[model samples]
Target: MNAAVHIPEYFEDCDLVEGEDLVREPAFWLAHVLLTMGDPGEVERYGVDASAYEAMVDRLADPGQPWPVLRVCFTGGHTAYVVYANFEDENNVDFFVRHPAWGRLGHLGQCGADEAGPGLSWAELISLAASAQDGEEGLSDPSQRLLLLLPMLGDADMPGGARDTVARALAGCGIRPDAAGELAASLLGEQDSTGGPRWTVTGDSPIAVCSSPYSPRRVPLGLGISPEQAQALANALHGSVPPTASGGFTG
Candidate 1:
């Protein structure tokens, strides 16, 4: 179940960015895809060889390419896969999620347009994946679910205005507003070992948000969740407010 084996050879040398927090901004996901599409300034900043980078982009953009252009690996051999053959020519992309234990592949959703019209953007698809995986174990604790949802705030003022937002959201789940506010502030302000906001839910082998090896972006990864729960949570969080467009990617 070594998920790394699933990574295509073309991306072998490319850096893998991981994290636990759900990144909710379309711009954040779009920026990464756009970077791979060719950002001369970003290439120069990263000191990547111009010609070599262009060659990788060419291979990724090949119309006949069959593998995913990007793979977001989660804990326990779960992965969220993305395919976009030519970002320059089309804004569309397809998304899939795989669970090794279940031996099942789930079509989460798609980004961009088709005969069915516009689809979810990359940000939306990622958010859906995160939410689905976060609730996979079926942790019913209001506080735990709050932790799972907090990262979706994405750089918002936590324990300040955002505390009220979390409290309000939790109130609907039966938590008192005042206690919910306190819990939200406590969790949002705490940092993980990497100095990023914490996202560890409480339970045996509890799910924790972890930082990416090569980038600042964080995503939640864990085990024991059913695909049905993943889909249900994804559908619920899909309507939540989108993240504000302020963060920037460094890798």
Candidate 2:
């Protein structure tokens, strides 16, 4: 297949090179995101408030350590991504972490990174990763999401008979009713016309979804998502919070 993405110039000659192939490296990645801090408007984009961002980074990492880490991941496409909250109004949104160094930069639009904003040095970050080589690699692999989701297919834990309805719909679509969970699981890899790992089905669009909520500016749920909405998604995905609770047409 075509390269997952055009390997950016940054990784043009890394020892990890594989003749322009997309090989699974770190399953899950956590870095301080030195570019965001002190960059006015960046910190708030990841949490409820600037202090919340500070508190989290401080709570989780040491001084001069990777703080307010953004989880980086790559699945189907060559891009690695991160989903966080919006700074403007506190909405949970996802965006690209492109560097051309990480094989491909996550975002390729107006977002700028001419130089490191204000934080650790590249050497320091590299050293940190080397030290944590033992850290576990995460799994958001596109092909396996279906299996991860199988247990929820007919579970009573799903709200408002939604699971049952979804199963029926899958069967109607000529998909095996038993593969209902696979369908939903498979969707974790997409949304709203844009490719991403985050997904949401609005009350307005029961049969569809939107992905990649942040671009330093939010796209509409019809297009992407906002922090408040992302938080609602978190609640639902974790608590079986019904779509109706988020004011949906589906209910």
Top-TM-score structure, candidate number: 1
RMSD of 2: 18.3
Q: Give the winner by lDDT.
A: 1
The lDDT for every candidate, in the order shown, is 0.37, 0.27
Tens-place lDDT digits, model 2, residues 25-74: 11111111222212323423222355544554443333232112222222
Tell me the TM-score of model 2: 0.21
- Candidate 1 per-residue lDDT over residues 1-251, each given as its tens digit: 11223434223443222212212222222233333222334333333345655665554445454433344443344555555534435644444455555444444334344311112222332344343333233223333333322332232112224445444444444344445555445434542334433333234322232232321222323133564645443444343435333321111
lDDT for model 1 comes to 0.37
lDDT of 2: 0.27
Q: For candidate 1, list the clashing residue pairs, or say none.
A: 18-212, 19-218, 19-219, 20-218, 20-219, 20-220, 136-225
Q: Against the correct fold, how does model 1 do in TM-score?
A: 0.31
Span of ten consecutive residues with least summed lDDT in model 1 = 17-26
